[model samples]
Target: MAEYDMQELTLPNEDGKRILYPRMQLYGQKDLEYIADKVSYATSFTRGDIKGLVQAITEEIAHSMSEGYSVKIEGLGVFTPSLGLRKDKERESGEEGAPRRNAASICLRDINFRVDKELLYETAGHCTLQRAQYKKCRRSSQMFAPEERLERAKEFMKKNTFMSVAEYCRLTGLLKTTAANELKAWAAQPDSGINYRGRGTHKLYVLRPANA
Candidate 1:
């Protein structure tokens, strides 16, 4: 097999216009099936129905945002219509405590998104496949046994003390579930890791040094 170099190519579009292509992203069929399964399991409706519903909801959100209104997608995040700032706010408390110009310039639509932790975790897990591929090219082994993967995961956590589980999975090529589980296990170690749970589905992990 020939090595594939990351390259940009010009390809013809549907209208016969040539467009520059950056890169290609391909999803495996099994991965798609797994996603379908997750959707089916998480929701009350059937998989096919939920898939269509998801697409429709996304289209609706796009349409709504295009009209300048924020559309909140459940378990995902908020999309808000944004407009450029007209003027900067004065940053003065009056005289001696006076500040100069406006503290913040440019205005944006007040849209906030709090992604569903479960969904985010699930999504982060799969991005590991891409990381795995990259690692395969650079390292001698494209294959990582479960135990090795677990050990590497621990080393990764030690190196990056503050990365989110999803980010860790992407960087380490470990599935989201695997990453989360490892974090829980690490936290279980006495005097080394912090408790990782809080109110109502909020998720976080912290590492603590025993000496400090």
Candidate 2:
């Protein structure tokens, strides 16, 4: 049986009313080996064969997506490639005579997956949900004011050269999304005492240069 719990919405609505939403209580992660073993017991294929096939299929999907092709398995779904600008490449919007972006500035941002309806229905058919006790939001950011958090972040960056979003969250007790958004906002402001290096998942926050 599957279990679920209610989580309070973090954002405020127009009426300033708090609301709760249902979220599944995950047991744990099942890796490739566990999946292979399960499939082996249900079919004639050995675990090794299943693992090899799965790996090969993943590699092929990556290769095809790199070549600008979307792959769709019968029972699975479509995997489409997505692109984004590389680090230091700003969008050429409203900038007069800015250098146009070339291939070097483009990168594979992500691969979008649209699940098949049949697979979704099949998975839903197997679920038996039971409501569990509600868990309170662990937003530690509530303990500190926004300015206090910024001071703490500046202190942290003084000793460390760079800080990842996860490290910032630990330092400020903020949720991941909140920490990331705040960091981006701070980086955008002039003399905000915070700046970021790199792009996408590799991004790291650093103290803004004194002269800049």
Candidate 3:
């Protein structure tokens, strides 16, 4: 069984006609573990055994492909290495009338996959789909006013020594650039109540002391 949501989508090119469709939300590792458990219960193999089997198969597939060999699983598909030739423009360097510094090169572009359509269709023979029980998003657009955002960060720093841009994004739902700029702006002011340390991903924001 799988769950989906009926979503209303409008494309910029479309004349603003709302299109309704079911959007599939995928399950992660939990689904795979559950399947392994069920299969183990119905067969002699244990769940651990089933997991190891899957891991072994996956490793072999990857190993074969890395060795420049094509792999084909009966119920899945074929995995083939696809090559791409880079056409880097030639530019004379070093001196006038000198030879071009670089030339075209070939590299592995991607792994090509051709699915087994018959096996996929057979696997979906008894499939079931249902609408998801929607829950409100934890955060949204205009989640907080500008002053309130700064206040929120100040309050957070009271409980914690520092706040990273990633932490602020998670707490305030602001994009990385927006959070970074806000933190930088607060830290730039001489008497502002916020300060940051380090640079880029290593940066952390802390509250400026009241006495300072």
Candidate 4:
């Protein structure tokens, strides 16, 4: 089994109660070594890793949508870009020489992103300088397991297989943390599992067949 490191962080509430959370292990040894080696290196990063990340994303989208279902990068909604040839009637000068030559086009019929409420709320808090409120909101439960939490989550999975953790929480009103842990439990089963993409702030989960 691969061991994942975890960081214990204490976030203080307005009234001073500390909320402890295990932040997912972020940087690994290779990452630390790279950062160490480049201490003096300054690279311009506009969101920084945009280009390579975008290409990787495009490849993923192409892979998933090859058969036509829309693919979504959440916060960003679904996108269905198609490659096609452009053919139109045209006459150069008045020669009436049939139509123009072949031309190709990549059409982005839908490119959209819907900001998450938590993201929006955090941004607003920062902009308004509401540090206290922001901190309190950030500590919001998105993590507790209720009385029927597991059963409810499993039932939800039955109806909406392969949903993201946030999406599942959104639909079922489960705390984000609780939903994540539930899915983690489901994954631990030898004959049932789920997979997720992204890490830290951008994580999203998907259900997989038991055999997978």
lDDT of 3: 0.73
Worst 10 residues of 1 by lDDT: 129-138
lDDT digits (tens) for residues 61-115 of candidate 1: 7788777677765667666665454354543457775655442654553555567
How good is model 1 by TM-score?
0.29
Model 3 TM-score relative to the real fold: 0.45
**Which pairs clash (backbone N, Cα, C closer than 3 Å) in model 1?**
78-113, 125-176
> Is candidate 1 or 4 superior in TM-score?
1
- Model 4, runs deviating above 4 Å: 1-43, 46-161
lDDT of 4 by residue, 1-212 (tens): 12122333466678876566433221122343344335424555433354556668888887777666668665545666454443443333445765454433333334344556666676556652211211112232444355354455455567766456655554445455755776666656644445655655445655555667
Pairs of residues at least 3 apart in sequence or in different chains that clash in candidate 2: none
Off by over 4 Å in 2: 94-96, 134-212
**Between 3 and 4, whose lDDT is larger?**
3
Error of 3 at 13 (Å): 5.0
Residue 143 in candidate 3 has what lDDT? 66
lDDT of 3 at 125: 90
Please list the C-alpha lDDT of all candidates, in the order they appear.
0.54, 0.82, 0.73, 0.50
What TM-score, to 2 decimals, does candidate 4 have?
A: 0.27
For model 3, which pairs clash? none
